[model samples]
Target chain A: MDSITHAPSTEVLRAIVEAAADGVVLCDADGAVVLVNGAAREMVPGDVTSLLDRGREPGETYETTLGDRRLRVRREIFGIVHQAWYLRDVTQESARADALRAERERTQFLVEAGRRLSASLNTRRCARATAELATGLLADAAMVVLPPGGLRRTAWLRSSEAGLEEGEIPVAHADQVPGLAEALAGFPPVPSRWLDPHQAPEWLLPAGFGPVGHLLVTPLPGNGVPAGALVLARREGGAGFDDETETLVRVFAARAGAAISAAVLYQEQSATNTILAGDLRPPPLPVVDGLELAGSLRAAQQTALIGGDFYDVLPTPDGPLVTLGDVCGKGPRAAVLAGQVRHSLRALLLLERDPEQLMHLINKALLSSYTPRSHVTLVLAAIRPGDGVIDLAVAGHPAPLLLRADGVVEEVDARGTLLGAIRSGAITLRTASVDLAPGDLLLLYSDGITEAFGGPTGREMYGSVRLMTALATCAGMPATAVVERLEQLNSDWLAGGVFDDRALLAIRRSR
Target chain B: MDTAPFLIEIENPEPGTTRLTLSGDFDYTTSADLATMTPTLMSRGLSVLEVDLTGVTFIDSSGLATLIHLYDAAEEHPAEMRFVGMTPYIVHLFEVTALDQVFNLPTSAA
Candidate 1:
């Protein structure tokens, strides 16, 4: 190898510069272009000097746009009196980076959409969230048209520069917006390109919004039916909805649809339950000529507000028939059975005045019913207001406690088989009679009162002994005050813990 | 209220006799277990069915209904169903519901 070498000639240097893949420009100290490579001439097409910043320091780089292409330029000192500028086309590289950023934004938007949409079970709130989330990123303005619930009108929510607005549109108005009716009917959405933005009705957009440039309508599919539809719009000259945005709208519509439909179903079920529970609630105690009566009932399932414990006072020509019963089980199932038992007692009271005979009739009625395991524990009391005598019959229930005027609590001596429990169809009941003097009260309570699992330890039961003790304190109080005080004490014993259904009814002889 | 886990153990103390030992809460939520075990309890050659409830801590109206249902099934099978073991709490419940008269409970357990 020869060690001695000299610099290449001008022609060779020029040839090497011309062969480079990057554009090369050489400028003299006075800023006049001295040489231009073939690549540099192709990159600018015109004067390349205009693309370079004269004030830029050597070794500094900058990017600039030349027509449709992006170019990155680097300035460097080439020799004692010359500066070199290198330029490379970066259009495709920047485009790829922009695409990646947009994809990430779309993913992040969907994640936010899922979290916001799933936080509510209310229909209006969910629709509002869907519309608010779609603005800024997905469109300039967004609207959500809820599924038609009533026959005449449907609800709508809109979000735009004016903020959120809600209104109800006539059901027939759905046909005015292109593709809206089809989308609401659970049909596949038409592509945004297929829709004419000019055809959007005035009602479909917010007030003062300019001419629409792009429109997209997508159906919100539900469990088995259509939940609702989404409407997106962009102002005139704004970016049109592309294929990626359309796909994102479909995914967002799916989540919104499930949330909306679930909310709708829940509202309907709760409304129905409310009606049924209203019927099962305890009735007002009738006013007896010589007696004062008070009753209170609480359900174990607080949401349902109906449970197995129930009490009713029915009036007859002779006196009022007071009935308290607890059907087997809890919640809605038990509530239905308790209602049946109450209705049966009312019907049977018209035929038989004796408490024992009513018990027998209810037993036979329940045993022959189609529902299995329909056991009921009931107490029927027939009062003779003239003589202040109460005829009591207890069947598979806790006996009523007699509170004398002097604070002596005695359990009424009555025992019987549970109504509808035995398959033999034969029930034995030992009925008893008790006289109520003035100021004396008779208290009938469900086992929930005595069997309450609450105390200082949080696990102990509020047993009968405790109940009798509590009753002793309320001997001289009014019937209403007595029930209220007892309930308060029991609730305090629970100490925020769970409890079962409790029913209490008090009868006081006033004269 | 927290409930104890319910458990049922089946054993054959002698020929033609099936003993079911039940422990824990015997309320509405757990009564279905006994009702489902009824068909299996009434096998061929079943002369007697014995229920041991000494380990039972709680019994609700639904639990009583399940027991009554079991008794009805046993009667239909022409077999004698007896309460072999019982806590005083159960005995008191049985007496209150008048089931003590209907069911074949042990005299000593009463």
Candidate 2:
């Protein structure tokens, strides 16, 4: 088969080779390329002509990728004098398929990231995911900085040198990391807005972030208050983030922001709850000779802060002291003030006597630290246990009702000014001595009980008269039962709910 | 954002005296308002301040603290504050901590 014997003119042969879509190469018997068509010069790599000598079996095809193009080659014996090779480019077709695959993977990554971010309410875990997400997608390193009331200056970071680092830096260094400062200040919402790492503060250049080319700082949106920040960096000479990448990072930041804020909010609430629970837990009432005491307190509603209502009965050297009082207002602030009052009163107990005179000293002590509108109302009684003699003093407080041995209930004739109401004064707290007979009991309560209101419409106050009527029914009951009755009656008055802070302390003289 | 937790109404019922009527929840939040108002009121050369708290439903430690601090302001101005219209129970709020003697208060029938 010597086709060269009848070969057509070179011009016509060249026209046929140039018009073909596939590349055409003609080589000599020694495997040297003698002629190449226009299509062959454009589509096929120049080195493919060497395959003619390798003596590939006829009609054999080889496929490989070169640069951005995919190419296929075929060898054929032409008239036995020379071998011809054909090469075709498939770059565009393969590129379309590869792009489709990458798009699918990116979608999957976004879906999985959302799930991981919201998986747990634990703040640290969520924050860690946020840091990893940056490294997972766009940036080589990341940091998440939480606002104060949390880690303060501590931040979550991942870099090339250190796998993942939770670094605690000085707050003053925030000047170096401009984006971090802005994030902490709740300024940035757009991603990669501060991408020019070159323009970063001079101090930030050597920030151990390792030759950062670009930076993206964003705020973790606090549900109510911004919780912290997310900062990401890429190496120098790396491709700058394009619009699509910025959008992707923005979406991720939003999810992480919401998740982190939720966790931080939950942590704060849990802490507040722990403190509230501890503060509201009442201490055990102490037992004294020939005296029985019972006490209880109920908050206005669920999740209310610990209030400033308190009661205590202690056995002192002179006599047994019984005190119940309501500090002005409620909540943690009041609780702290009441705590100071209680401890100071405890210390003053041994040194001072005569309720009115003792109140004078207590007033002076309270004046030591002047807080506006601060005043204390209390019924303090020093009882000679078993002897049946009780000395009671009132400091601008509600009168204590005495359940006499008979069927009659009498109000203790007591009067006084409020504590610390005057800077310099001998307090006029009224002190009265009354002999307690067997079966006589004394009850002290915070106003939360009587002030409680309920009716069919829930607006009628229980009032002092109703409380007195309720007490008349508990005449012969034990001290514990009396306290229970007080609470039960108050609850019954409110019917479906509660009023302000309520406390009840009942002490009965043993027969 | 919301309405003030409490309201304070000021008036000059008589010469040499200033009166304030308070209503609503006067707790931690409104304490500063009262604190700021008192010093300015005292600095007006008034001899007495009369606060009517009949309408107040709640008060907190900050409220109390503000009052104690006002005592100094009153002294500096050589004026006096008389707190009135306290319910019997509210009177007890001022007594337990022995703050009753620090301010001039209404007499309890008891």
Candidate 3:
């Protein structure tokens, strides 16, 4: 102790304390402020002793809010009789953490919105998801006004604590809510502050809902068309829609709009397809005396139901003119061409009943068609009821099979150029006369029957020989039974594999 | 069923003559490739266009349409389009559609 030379005095300690960045205060054992640093005086200003907790144990730390500023205070034993209090301003740090929390919440909400909105291709369901997602986070209540589907009314879905509700409002009623009419018309949203909440119509809110404090209206833009609009409401006691919340709403609306519009487009396309397919479906065969008729058609594209192959039995005074044809290509385009051919055949048949003459007329019609490559393979059979004679003319089509009562099948010897093919417009026909004996069946089919790509190896064709053999097995059966049996056998040969459009028609002479 | 991949090989064996050798399944899905190549195949000075279908395993209605389209374009070009090679299956298809009467097929195919 005697060897120590320079010991710092209280003045040096006071100077060092005054120069420190943190606010420091010293208190005597009597619990009164004995010394205060420059930083402590600036922080506390008027009452430095009031900021300290004299009862706190030494080295204990605590946080306190002074006015708008946040102070972190720690108490420590200075010497034996004095206590030191350290204070730090942490106001900006806490505010930054709060902003980070808000940012995370916004990101989470968007992720959840995307998940819910993309789950449905139905317009109403998508609208419902949009309204539900906007509630709680964006507003106390949210409403989605769907685009006007009819002239008189538009649908609306609302979500709140009371649960989801749906209703229709008159198209003109959109104007009752401020900015709603413009938003529904696909205009940009009117800022919430610009619109008065008192102008909101009663129908926009649920029953027993409190007075609206704020209202936000935004348009849902779609692919070149307006999808709908979104309406948000906060009750009188709730927080008003701020800038950040409004921006979030705009982003959410954009996604919801795209999903709803896509669903609308899909619905329209499928409806049109259904109507076209319905028109191209095979017609029921007309009953011809002394003859049984049956037919079946299966398209390669199962969803379309209509294909390139078609058959119709047209009634005539002389007899029934049965036609089976395969148009080039497949699906809606081919089905449309097939429909055109059928209509042309009907128009041509009104003037000409002779199978060969009809073939020439159809060939002329097809060759003159604006659609290129509109070729068709067809077989026309004119049945003579009294004598069981059928005049058959084959045009670029497979020969009709003769299923004799004795279980013998023969391919009719007939050939002709495909109609509408050969830009030269020349088609030669070698028509044949077939005498259908009692219980004899005549079968006309498209090439799809023979070209099916399934068997034991899953790549072998069903082939004409297999078809002939199969036909021979159903020699004496009724026409319907014969057609059904042949189809069942072919489907089995395919074994659930992919296939082209197959068509089969049968004409039988009953005993 | 898995279909064979379609391929088209073009060659100029002689002046003013183009030979297209087609292989694999030439059906609805793949016939567009040939149809799209029609303009290029029917270029000016194409005096003779020879098609070889010996390597082709299958042909459908769409494929048949494309061939007819090519033939029509050739006829319009005042050029001769002929089938230089074919399988028995294609020969039967030609005979059925009576395209054999219009298209100039090799003697073996006939």
Q: All models: lDDT?
A: 0.90, 0.72, 0.90
Q: Chain B vs. true chain B: TM-score for each candidate?
A: 0.96, 0.86, 0.97
Error of 2 at B42 (Å): 3.6
Per-residue lDDT tens digits for candidate 2, residues B47-76, read 987878788765555566676677667777
Better of 1 and 2 by lDDT: 1
Instruction: Please give the distance, in angstroms, between residue A345's alpha carbon in candidate 1 and its true position after superposition.
Output: 2.6
User: Candidate 3 at A413: error in angstroms?
Assistant: 1.9
CAPRI tier of model 1? medium
- DockQ for every prediction shown: 0.70, 0.15, 0.72
Q: Residue A184 in candidate 3 has what lDDT?
A: 84
The sequence of per-residue lDDT tens digits that candidate 3 reaches over residues A1-511 is 5787787998999899999999998888887888888887887778877778777888898988899888889999988988889988888998898889999999999999999989988989999999999999899899999999666899999999999999999999999999988998899997899999999989999988999999999999888888999999999978888899889999999999999999888788778767766656779888787889999988776654346888999887788899999998866778789889899888888889999999998998888889888989999999887999999999999899999999999999999999998877788889999999999999999998999989999988899999999999997799999999999999999999988889999999996
Instruction: Looking at model 1 chain A, report the run of 10 residues with the lowest lDDT sum.
Output: A298-307
Rank candidates by lDDT, best first. 1, 3, 2
Clashes (backbone N, CA, C under 3 Å), per candidate, total: 0, 36, 0
- Per-residue CA lDDT of model 2 for A150-207, tens digit only, reads 4436655443335666655666666577567777777755446445676555333325
Of 1 and 2, the candidate ranking higher by DockQ: 1
The 10-residue segment of model 3 chain A with minimum total lDDT is: A299-308
Candidate 1 A-chain TM-score: 0.86
| Model 2, global lDDT | 0.72
Worst 10 residues of 2 chain B by lDDT: B89-98
Candidate 1 interface RMSD (Å): 1.1
